[model samples]
Structures are given as C-alpha cells and as structure tokens.
Target: MSTSSHHRPRDLRLDFFRGLGMFIIFVAHVPENSWTLWIPARFGFSDATEIFVFCSGMASAIAFGAAFRRHGWWIGFARTAFRVWQVYWAHIALFMVTVALLLVFDRINPSVEYTERLYVIPFFEDTASAFLGLMTLTYVPNYFDILPMYLVILAMMPFVIALARISEAVALAGIGILWLFATSGYLNLPAEPWSDREWFFNPFAWQLVFFTGFAFMSGWLKPPPVNRWLIGLAIAILVVTVPFAHRWGWQNAEWIFEARDLVWGGLEKTDFGVLRYVHFLALAYVAWVAAGEGGRRLAGGGAWGRFVAITRKVGQQSLAIFLTGMVLAQVMGMVLDLIGRNMLTWALVNLSGFLILIATAYGVAWFKSQPWRKPSAAEASGSRSGAQGRAEPVSRRSELAAGE
Candidate 1:
C-alpha cells in the first residue's frame, strides 16, 4: 500500500457521533433516570446500540480493511482475530466484575432484588453450569449482550472484507438475504441453558447495519449528495413519528394514529425491524444535511471543538470507557435502590457518572500517549539477534499496523 493510503486522516464526524453515542449509552444503561426519558430511543425505533454497532463496523473496516489492502489477507485476518479475542476477554472480565458487584449488593441488602433482575439468579442456583455458560457466551445478561454480538460480527469481518473485495453487490446481497431470514425469525442462535431465549441483538440481522457502515468506509458505497427533498421527507417522517414517542413516556399509552401491521411492523429490536431501520436511515439523512460543513468546521475550535476533542478521545478508546460505564451504571442502580430514586439523585448520579467516564477516557488517551523507554544497547543487540534467528519474516508495516 502507498504511504498516502495509510496516512489518510480520520473523519471527525464519525468520531464526534461515536463519542455522542458513548455518552448516550452510559445514560441509557443507568435505568430510572430522568435523563433516560429524553434519550433518542424514547422518540424513535432505534437506540444507541445502532450507533455503536454501525460506527464499530465503520471503524473496523477502516482499520482492518486498510491492513488487508496494504499487507495481505492473512495479516488482516490476524488483526480481526485479535480484536475478537480482545472483545471476548473484555466481556468475560466485565461479567465477572458485574457478578461480584451484584453479589456484594446482595450481601448488603438481601431483599434488594438485584439477583433475579440482573439475571444472575442462575449463577447462584447453579454455579457450575452458569459459570460455564458465561464462558461459552450463552449466559449473557441484559445490557451485556451487545459485546458478544459485536464479537461475532468482528469474527466474521475478514470474510466480509474478502467478499467485498470480490464484488460489493454480491457481498451486500448475501448480507441482505441473511438479514431477511433473521428478521423472519426462522434463523437465530438459541441460548443453550435458556432454551427458548435467543440472543438479544442478533448478529445475523444486525450485520446489515454493521456492514453498511463497513461498505461506506471501504469506498464500496458512496454517499449520495445531500438532497433538500430527502431532508424534507425525513423531517416529515420524524414529525409523524412524534406520536409514537408517547408510548415511552406513559405505560399503556394509546397511539394517536395507529397504522395497519402491513404498513409498518412493530419495533422488534433483536431483528432490527424494518420500521426501525428506515427510521434510522431517515434520521441519518436529516443529521447529515443539518450538520453539513458547519459540523466539520466546528471541530477546528471553540467550545464545540473542545467537546468534540473529548468525545473523539472517548470514541477512540470506547471499549475501556464502555466497560467502565457499565460497571458504574450498575453501581448507580444499587445506590438508587438503597437510597431511593428521585430527580435529584438521578441528576447527581448521571452527571457524576458522565464526568468519571470522561476522566477515564482522558486517562486512557494519556496512557496511550506516554513515551516508551528505549532499550539498552545490550538489549537492542539481543533483540536483533533474536529477530535474525527467527525463520518467518516479519513485515515492519504489519508491526506498525498492530492496533488501530
């Protein structure tokens, strides 16, 4: 690959939106918050999960696809494999910590009802099987399923990249067919111990959104010029959908204008329902038009620029920040249960949690930026000798491309 290809600058828009999504995820994860009422999910068919998955797909393509194009298929495959391993370990570690937290909470207040709600009751009842299931990715608790789904998608990314290389249309067609089958509920991976249960975010279906981002980043799909009519149409749809947002605010709230099932299927998050997908597309179009060049320019300087910088850092080190957010959210939930839930408590917890998450992101960024110590002359000589002794040749380009 040419140096220019490898040196392409990152898109500020992606980083900004991804950082925004991270904040939204943190808020959404902590339930019973007044802020949760105002999350985009309350007004639309989709939530932060879509943004996270889609952006992740785009990021993966840019990072791994470049490697495949520059080095070789195997190198890219190795990179993808490493990512899957990283996510798998992260998920497991998060699970262990979460379990520990819940156990502690239970000991503090046995009647708090944290066990059954968090879906760790099985872990207490059947420790051996539950522990095994967790390790095998079958005992996924609520809010913990997203990473596993992402893991599956990243694991299959090498093949997706190769297929796109061959023919974008064919690759996308295959993905569409899989998505259609998944949506029809004919195809799904079953949760073993929980026989009737399926993965919360189905990979087969959600891959459509993921690969859509991948295709766009890989240059297989070119974004169309912002059209005024499309923006108007999107705005109109959002206005029409405002009534649907009421369901979130009030329990058993009747729709002001109900439509037939044939016109729009109900929102099914697992399968990425047709209505939700279309709603997301409409939202994306409107956002693109609204942001325009002003959004790009804002990244240069000002209050918005600093905001973007912080978010971009959070987005860059999303995994660590996300894990921290999940654990923190649970802690906040426990605090609320003990003290009681109210507007003041909600505001304090969320505001404090957001600050902590931002600090964690900055910490990761600072750590990453720290300079490494140079090896001593003797150590350098030994390293050179070891490299010479190795049979397989190592590519310096591949070494530089280790992490993205």
Candidate 2:
C-alpha cells in the first residue's frame, strides 16, 4: 500500500494494455491511414482515448495514491504537480516540433498547406493573442487539447485524495457531480476565443473514466468477479455493436449511425457519452479477464512473451512515446499524403511508426535509468568487461516500468 515497499510487483497487463493503446493511438492519429479503419474505435463506441485515460488513471493511482497513503497528502500532490509540469512542457514541445516540421514541409511542397490542415495557421496568423492563448491554454486547438485536459485532472488529484481520506463515497460523489454537469453541457473550459466551443476532452466529463481506474487501483473498488455471465455480456456488447460502428456499415446502412446517436443521446465523444463508457468498460473487462493473474498470458519465457515485454516497455515510457508518436504520426501523414495511400504505403508507414515507438520507449527507458550516475565497483567492473544496461538496480527498473 506504500511506495516505500519498493519491490512491489506490477501487473504487466497495465503496461501491456497501455502500450497497446499507445500503438493504436499512433495509428489513429496519422491523417487518413487505412489501417485506422480497423482500430477499436471503428468496431465499437470507444477508442484508444478511453484506453489511455483509464490506464493512466490506474497508473496515477498506483504511483501517487500509495505515496499519499504512506508519505502524506502534500507529498502526493507535489508528485502529481511535478508530472503535470512535465506533461505541460511535453505539450509545448509537441506543438513546436509539429508546427516547425509542417512549415518546413510546406515550404518544399507549396501545393500542400500542412499547417492549415492541422489548424496551426491561426497561431501564426495572430501570434500575439494566439501565442498568449496557447501559453495560457485559452486557445486549445482540437489536436492539442489532450494535455490541457490531462493536466487539469492531475491538478485535481489532491482534492480526490483528500476526499478519499475523509470518505470514499464523498470522492465518488464529487466525481459523479462533475460528470453530470459536463455531460449535460453545463461545465467545460473554453477552447478558443473566436466564438463558443469547449475543450474536446472535457476534464469534468472524462474524469469519470479516469477515477474509475483510480478507484480500482487504489482499492476503493474491488475487481469485478470473473463470471461466465459477465464475460458473455461483455462479449455481446462488443460483437453486437460492431456493425453500428464499422465504416462499412455506416456507408451501406446509414440508419445504424442514426440509431446509435439516438440510443446514446448522441454518442458524443467530446462529452464522454453513455454508450462509450459502457462499451469501454466491457472491452476493458474482457481484456482484464484474458490477461489473467499477474498478466500470466503476457508474462513467461518465449517469443510471444518477449514481444509482450517489449510492448510493456512502450507503455512504461508512454509519455515520451506518446509525444514522439504524435509528431511522427504527422510526419508519416505527410509522407502518405505525398506518396498517396495504397495498401503497401499504409503497411510500411504503420509498421515503421510502431518500430520508431518501440525504439523511443527503449531510448527513454535508458535515459530514465540515469546512466550518468556513478556505478558500484561490481557494476564498474562489469562495464569494463562489456556489460550494458542490465546492471541497473532492480528497484529503479521496477519503479520506471510501473509508472511513466
């Protein structure tokens, strides 16, 4: 229950699923990638966004919540604030790199307006106000809204933790109230100054998903029992809803989309619509059941196990990979746009993106391992004798792998 217990084992499934979500998110972000047609979003009401927010909340609970319990409230809030600061800088970096690259490409290919495509032009057009808004987060573009929403939630973690200290019901009630206000369209931060629009991922609405994961991981809620009936219902929810979500069905049978909108009161992703929540929980349950205890399905010695471990690495250093993935996705989108999207181009871009993400994960892991630090005599001898990264202390490795 305490971060002082440094050797605590992590459930590999968390990293595995979160890493898988990162990869899927990469696929989803690239503009017009054919592979995107088959992503979870296309098959159900929810997508990798759910996977990300939910898993991130669980990771936060594991990393921050336990610390709060052991070290006290202020320390836990400090850790969360530090993470928010890191993510804030990462967001700025993501935007800068993306805009710079797009401008460079646009200069070369005068026929294409890449900046306009992603809505980066407004910043250049009105640098004074737009830059101020960007810095203040008053003009959050659609593509760059994720971090703003994320940091807002991180800023609220202390309140939730403080509430849980008093009573779990009070914390849950707080979360529910926000969800109600936001989903009802009464609560949200303004995204841009031009007219009237709210943040794409409304923190108030999305906190429901985040806190659900937090509650489970913090032991506020028990894991659902694995029963045949539960599994059946989850499967049915996934299977029966596919046609309504699939691109082919939307093209061939338009009513499915309309029906979906009607059934969920609009299925609006911005507000974290009802059907999306249910569908994501069902999918998450099925995945949780399949991973089994201690991620037995993903842990073991073999080819598949090794691949699973690699994916978990990607998940462990998710923030770096996510930033890299977003920028790389835009690069791949430019490549695809120039070359045109055929089956071969799609496969190459998607596979190369995945490899780059994997490499990013390992690279970030090496950096987080803090190679600049001095080593023990045994480590020094091993280093002189051709040893590499494997010499890092077990606890440090566990800590890095458990949280990003």
Candidate 2 structure quality by residue, lDDT tens digits, 1-404: 11222322344778889999999999999998989888899999899999999988988987887778888988888888899898888888888888999998898777889999898788888888888778888889998988888889888889998898789989999998889889998988888877588788899889889999888887777788889999999999999888888878867786876786577654688889888999999999999888775556777888998899899999998888889999999999989988889999999999999999999999989988897796888888988766345555666788899997
Q: Rate the local accuracy (lDDT) of all candidates.
A: 0.78, 0.86
Query: Per-residue lDDT for 201-320 in model 1, tens only?
Result: 889889988987787777777765667887788988777666665464334543443442334444678888877787777776676566565355535677877877888878888889
Worst 10-residue stretch by lDDT in candidate 2? 1-10
Residue 312 displacement (Å), model 2: 0.2
* Number of clashes found in candidate 1: 0
TM-score of each: 0.86, 0.90
Error of 2 at 330 (Å): 0.6
Candidate 1 off by > 4 Å: 1-10, 248-266, 374-404
